[model samples]
Target: MISVEEALRIILEESKALEGEEKNILSCLNKVLAEDIYSRDNLPPFDKSAMDGYAIKSEDTDLYKDGVSIELEIVDLIKAGESSDKELKNGQAMKIMTGAPVPEGANAVIQIEKVEVREDTLHISEKVKNGCNVIKLGEEIKVGDIALRKGTLIRPTEIGVLASLGYSKIKVPRNPVVSILTTGDELVEINETPKFGQIRNSNEYSLKALIQNLGLEALSFGIVEDKKDTLKSKVKEALEKSDIVITSGGASVGDFDFVEQVLNEINADIKFQSVAIKPGKPISFAVIDKKLFFSLPGNPLSAITTFEEFVKPACEKMLGKNMESDNTFPVILAEDFKEKEGRSKYIYVKIKAENGKLYAYKAGSQSSNQLITMSKANGIIIMPEGIGYKKAGEVLSGKFIFK
Candidate 1:
């Protein structure tokens, strides 16, 4: 068995980012950019009005003081998405709406609320500074400047920027296709009623949903029986069709465990057969033909924990993205916890905020098969290896898992 850190390092070191493909910007949400994107034109394209006001020369309002009012002739009216060719003369003002282009010779804008308009003339009561309420050309983004660096994850704001840059399509790293296979003779389809000794196949469906939530394509191969030949055939098919293959169950050294045997038969390079973590200790990792493989434990909590800790980071690495931190922070234990030492333990916890302080208590039973306990947990309290007992009020590092 190896430490969790070592296992992750091995997985990332062996994985490489997928190739890039040109995709429509609309379809590139969550995708990583393959090249640095530069602004083709200045943001705003031209000097623009930042508010609905009158564009006038700063000199016009320079001499105005308290109880003094200045009036100027209205030369033109400009609304957003429109431009005016008329230039502002001395003692002249243009009625400009927000986002409208600033007319030539206009150095500042006085908001309509600060002025009293009567017919074709405007009465300004407030002194305006030069260049106030004006957005200069290229103020936000300059032409030929790097608007977004390579490896940036496309979000809604990024989409807006790409549209402004006239980019209909962008080059981004391809999302890896993940194939899921659940192996066990005791597992039955979700739609069917299990016999006295069988259970519904929830692992495959849960794993599939988790994969999709991570923005990766998931291909479900359904449940493969415990038979070695059947598992081997299904595993072979998944390997050919996916960049990452994940099989839940048949990872431990049980009589029905056939996943390890199949991997060995295919001459796969098994990186680690176990990790020094409770509930997910039997997890296995391997690589075959440059494709990643993960054999998660049969238990639901164990499977989910291993996937979040190991597979999630591997996927991020394959997409040329920095791994997101778990956002772990210290929390006061609400109750005492006692366990034998040997492996790192992750206990499901429900967190409560009291007087601006966070307190963590066990959700319920810590059994790996207790799905309800996992559901009630918003975070996980981590107890490092060799530490056994934790009394109430003790500070421990906890990570929000439901985020």
Candidate 2:
């Protein structure tokens, strides 16, 4: 078996960049931007008033002392969205509202509440400072500046910025369509109660949820019986209609493990046979024509882990989105853990806070066939190769399922 890192490198080397599509501004939220967005024009576009006040020159006010009154002429009254027609001169002040353009030669703006206005003559009691309450042109953003870069995933704030820049449509990468096929003769649908020696088909539903969490769409093809002809037909049909094809249960080395055989029969070039990882050693990858195919283990926990660690990054990177995992953290073990000295082991454990100390305890049995243990686990404590039993207070890097 090849190391997990080597297998991943081989898989990503075959990743082809996804093409982009035109989307309406409303629908482009959270989609990766395919082109850089530059500002159409200067923000504010002109020198404007930042507050509702009287625009005047520094020499217009002589009432520096408190309660002292100086009579000045109100030459013009400007409201928001209106441009000033007259320039400010000595002994003249303009009543300007917030967002109104300040006239040329205007030095300061004294608030209306600070002055008493009788007809066109305004009495200013407080002295005004020079260049107060003014927003310079292009202060927020300049014209022709790159407001948003290409390959940026649009968020709520990015949408607001695009709208402010007068962008009603955006170019973004089309989301990849994942076709899920769960294979097993002993599996039954969720609606039907399982008969003796049969289990409910959980991989399909779980895989659908996992795809949704990555912001991708999943088209489920339900449970497939363990037969060569049926599996080939289904896999071929799914690959034809989907960008990525995923199948479970038929990947492992067993009498019924026919996924790899079917994929090879359909001419899917095998990229990697197996990875050195615990509970997911049967993971496989191949490419049919130009589409991607992932053969995950039959176990639910193994399927989810392999998908997150491998398949998700490939999909995200192809879509031009960030694919780095920021969930890895150092955790203190709550109990001793033993594993083989060569291959890395992912131990499912539940973490808790005890008197301000973070400790991780093994949830249940470590058997790969046991789903109850995986279900009860909150995180996976990573046990690297060459390490023996891990005792309490031993710090090991772990992946957190949730923050």
Candidate 3:
């Protein structure tokens, strides 16, 4: 067995980022950028009017101070997407809409609400400061400026920035294709009514959902029987088609456990057979033909916990992103909890804030087979090894899993 930190380090050190591909910006959401993107032009290509009002020289409104009103002749009207070549001379104003380019020689804009218009003339009651309500050219981003750095995850805001740069297509790291397989003789399809001593297959679907949530493609190979030959055949097929293969069950030491044997038969390089963690000690990791393989525990909670702790970071590394710990917070334990020596413990809990203090309440049973507790939990309390027991109100580090 190896520590979780050592296991993760091995996986990341062996992993390599996938090659880049040019994809349409519309379809690149959540993809990591492969190259730095620079702006081709200023964010606002020209001097823009920030408000829908009259554009006039700042000196024109100077005399209309302290309750005095000044009227100037309206020379032209400029709306968004429209340009005016006419220049504003003294005592002249232009009715410009928001986002419209400011006419030449106009240094300020007065909001329409602040002035009363009579025909082509405008009355401005307040003295407008120079450059007021006007977005100067290149105010936000200048030409050739680095708009986005490499390895940045593309979000909606990033999409807007790319659109402003006229990038219909962008280069991004390719998303890894994951294959999910489940093993057990007592497992039945989800639609079938399980007979005595049989259970429905839930891990496959849960793992598939989790893979999709990470913006990766998942191919399900269904459930394989707990036989060495059958498991070997399924593993071969998954390895041929996917960049990563994840299997649940048959990894622990038992009479029916044959996943390890199958991997050995295939001559896979086993990185680790076990990890020093509770509810997930039976986890296995191997690499076959330069492709990654993860053998998770059979229990539902254990499978999910191991996935979050190990597989998530591996996937991020493959997608050309720096691995970081999931968000965590310090919470006061609402109840006493015991930890086993020489093994880290992950306890499911629900977090609640009261009186500006965060509290973690144990959620249901912490058994690996109990799916109800995992479903109700919003966070996990990590209890390090050697800590015998913790009293209520003791501070513990917790990571939010949901919301």
Candidate 4:
């Protein structure tokens, strides 16, 4: 067994980002940029009016001081998407609508509401400063400037930016296809009644939902029997069809556990067979033919725990997302808990906020098979290795779940 950090490092070091593909900008939302995006044309393209206003030289209104009004001749009216050829001289103004290009030699625009116009003469009581109410050419983004760097996440705001930059199609990393397979002879489908000493398979459902939460679809190969040859064939097929394969069950050491044997037989590079983490120690990670394979424990809580805390990061990295930052925060324990000293313990609990401090309370029994314990939890408190038994009022690092 290895430390959780070492196991994670091995997984990430073995994972590789997918190749880039040309996707339509609209469909590229939530995707990672493959190249630096430089502006092909200046935003706005020219000096335009920020609002409905009159464009005039700033010095033209210098004489209007002490609540005095100044009058200027109106040269022409420029509406949106229109331009004025008239040169704005001192004592002359052009009525420009929002988004209308300002005429040459104009340095200021006074809002229409702040000025009165009568008989083609514009009157302004307040002195308009230079560059007032005017959006200069390339104010948002200049030509040749990088608008977005490579590896940036594309959001709705990025969609608008790309559209403005005339990027109808963009290059983004290809999303990896994930496959799910559940194993065990004692497991039955949710719709079927389990025989004596059998239970319904819930790990497949949990894994599928987890994959969907990451905006990726998973193909389920249904349930495979515990036989070594059958499990081996299904694992091979999953590897052939998908970039990532996740199998929940037949991972732990037991009379019927055959995940390791099958992996060795297939010549797969098994990175780690176990990690020093409670409820998920039997999880295994392997790389075969440039594809990732994860054998998660059969227990429902253990399977979910391993997937969320370990497999999710590998998937995210392949999709060109950063996952280096730790989400743990100091949380006070509201109840006492005890465990063995060999592995790091992750206890699911209800976190409550009182007086701006977070406190972790027991949700239920922390059993590997008890999915109810995980269901009732909003967060998890992590107890580090070496030390055991934490009493109420003790503090541990914790983070919200499924956040």
C-alpha RMSD for every candidate? 2.0, 3.6, 2.3, 2.1
Q: Model 3, which residues run further than 4 Å from truth?
A: 61-71, 116-120, 125-127
Q: What is the lDDT of candidate 1?
A: 0.90
Name the lDDT of candidate 4. Answer: 0.91
User: Per-residue lDDT for 289-335 in model 4, tens only?
Assistant: 99999999999889999998888888888888777788899999988
TM-score (all chains, Cα) for each model: 0.93, 0.85, 0.91, 0.93
Pairs clashing within candidate 3: none
C-alpha displacement of 359 in model 2, angstroms? 5.3
lDDT tens digits, residues 211-233, model 2? 98877889999999999899999
Candidate 2 clashing pairs, residues 3+ apart or interchain: none
Q: Following a full C-alpha superposition, what root-mean-square deviation does model 3 have from the true structure?
A: 2.3
lDDT of 1 by residue, 51-115 (tens): 99999998898888889798899989999988888989999999999999999999999888888
N/CA/C clash count, model 4: 0
Q: Kindly report which residue stretches of model 2 are placed more than 4 angstroms away from their true locations once superposed.
A: 51-54, 58-79, 92-98, 107-133, 324-327, 334-340, 350-362, 369-378
Superposed model 1: Cα runs more than 4 Å off = 324-326
Q: Rank the candidate models, highest TM-score first.
A: 1, 4, 3, 2
How many clashes show up in model 2?
A: 0
**Residue 350's lDDT in candidate 2:** 93
lDDT of each: 0.90, 0.83, 0.90, 0.91
Error of 4 at 56 (Å): 1.7
Estimate the lDDT of model 3: 0.90
